[model samples]
Target: MNHPLLDQFNQWLQQFEQTGSVIDTTRLNEWNHLMDQFQTHPEQLSSNHAQWIKTLAQNSKAMMSVVEALQDQATDSSEQLKKLREELHQFNVQLLLQQASLPQQMAPLLFTHTHLSTLFNEEQLAKFEQLKSSLNTPQFEKLNQLIESFMQWQQAGQTLTEEMNQITELATQTWQEQFDDSLSAKDQIELWGKIYDNTYQVQFQEPSMQLAQSGWLNGWADLKLAWKQLLTQLTEQAGLPSPEQLDRMIEQLDQQRRRIRQLEKRLSALESGDHNG
Candidate 1:
């Protein structure tokens, strides 16, 4: 059984050989074995490949959902920030009004000799003047400055949230465009590849996108770690090997197999040398 892909691979291998390009024998052998398996069991290989592709499509759909979720989160954050800014402004206005009315409200307590005498002595009355002076000058100014700083901070936050919303919206739109139902599987895969490349470029170029990407990657990493831990615990409870343990076992087996292959190659070389001798 001949495959066009295998024929193309053979052509490339022949070209590499004619060009005297170095190729890893182990990798070449692996490719040859895989091709041989595909040739021998075309139906089984095709079925498996189709299943793998289906899995990829499912993953891509899941990714689309994640992107949409991110967009919703960003929009929610922007709205929340806008609401907070409005509340902050209202609070600042109320605070300033309270601060302005404080002197009038305390006038009798500070200046009325009869009321002052009931509350404190002459020394305490004198200190009240200082308190009034401080509040009227430095404290009032400081409160205004603090409110201004808070407003500035809120503005910065609003700007950041807006940028995040825009980026997420663009990403969502791009993904939706790529995931056309009319597109074939191969075209969808190619479009996804292009999306990845474009996203990679944009992430580097846009600082906001880079920050968003970093946060997303960190969140995903934490989620993956938590999932793995859960899996490990579940597997332990079931008296089965965890994925990490199985992976380590596979790695050790591969190393042992590689060592055996190397020994066999050396023995074959020695045998050939002896025959020549």
Candidate 2:
């Protein structure tokens, strides 16, 4: 009874009995039932299903196109980023190469600056004048040019230093105004002390002070050497005794005086003995 071929034969017999035709009556009944279900035409459902499939196909194509476009954009962006990184790396390498040579390039300039500074100091001018006979006109002119250049650089440095000091003072004043306005006197003192220790002392004032002190010491040493050289030349030219020669003469005089004193003591002792006899 449950055999599928027999069931089909029965359906054929039922359709033959009803309409004199061998149509599948069960399928026909199902179509009729579906037609009665909705007020619209049955073919409209098929048409809607077809339209839905077409729309899904179109949407799928459009989504695939968008995905492809996004992939292309991502590839382009990645390539551009790679190029940018490569350029940056090359620029950094160039900067490093320049930095490596900077110290060597600056060394001779620093030496000239210090040398000109040592020679042109106002305190050493007198002794520097004494050196005039030793130098030619060209040498003096060259020295003057170097001194002028050094002075220009020094003036620029001083201007920059003043600007930096002003900035620092302004920043400190701003900080005080912002945070210390309501502080107690003792707290304000502590705040300033901290600020000095943390910022101004370390960053500005202390280094500047140390640089000035070092310059003074170096200038003093150079001045002393210049004075010694000047005096030695003057003494030699004037036919006056040098310091070493003067020391030797003083040593001889001291020895002669000691011998005279010893002789006088001996004579005094001899006289006393004679008187006692």
Best lDDT among the predictions, by candidate number? 1
The local distance difference test score of model 1 is: 0.52
lDDT by residue for model 2 over 152-248, one digit each (tens)?
A: 3344334434434443455455454556457895786577557644654454455664564344444444433443444455576699876557768
Give per-residue CA lDDT, model 1, range 168-263, as digits (tens). Answer: 445445866656879886797588657645754675588775664454444434434444554565677699999779889999999999999999
Give the clashing pairs for model 1: none
Q: What C-alpha lDDT does candidate 2 achieve relative to the native structure?
A: 0.48
lDDT at 248, model 2: 81
Question: What TM-score would each prediction reach against the true structure?
Answer: 0.29, 0.24
> Could you tell me the C-alpha RMSD of candidate 1 in Å?
28.9
Highest TM-score scorer: 1
User: Ten consecutive residues with minimal summed lDDT in candidate 1?
Assistant: 112-121
Q: Relative to the unseen true structure, what is the C-alpha lDDT of residue 71 in candidate 2, on a scale of 0 to 100?
A: 47
Off by over 4 Å in 2: 1-179, 183-194, 204-216, 235-277
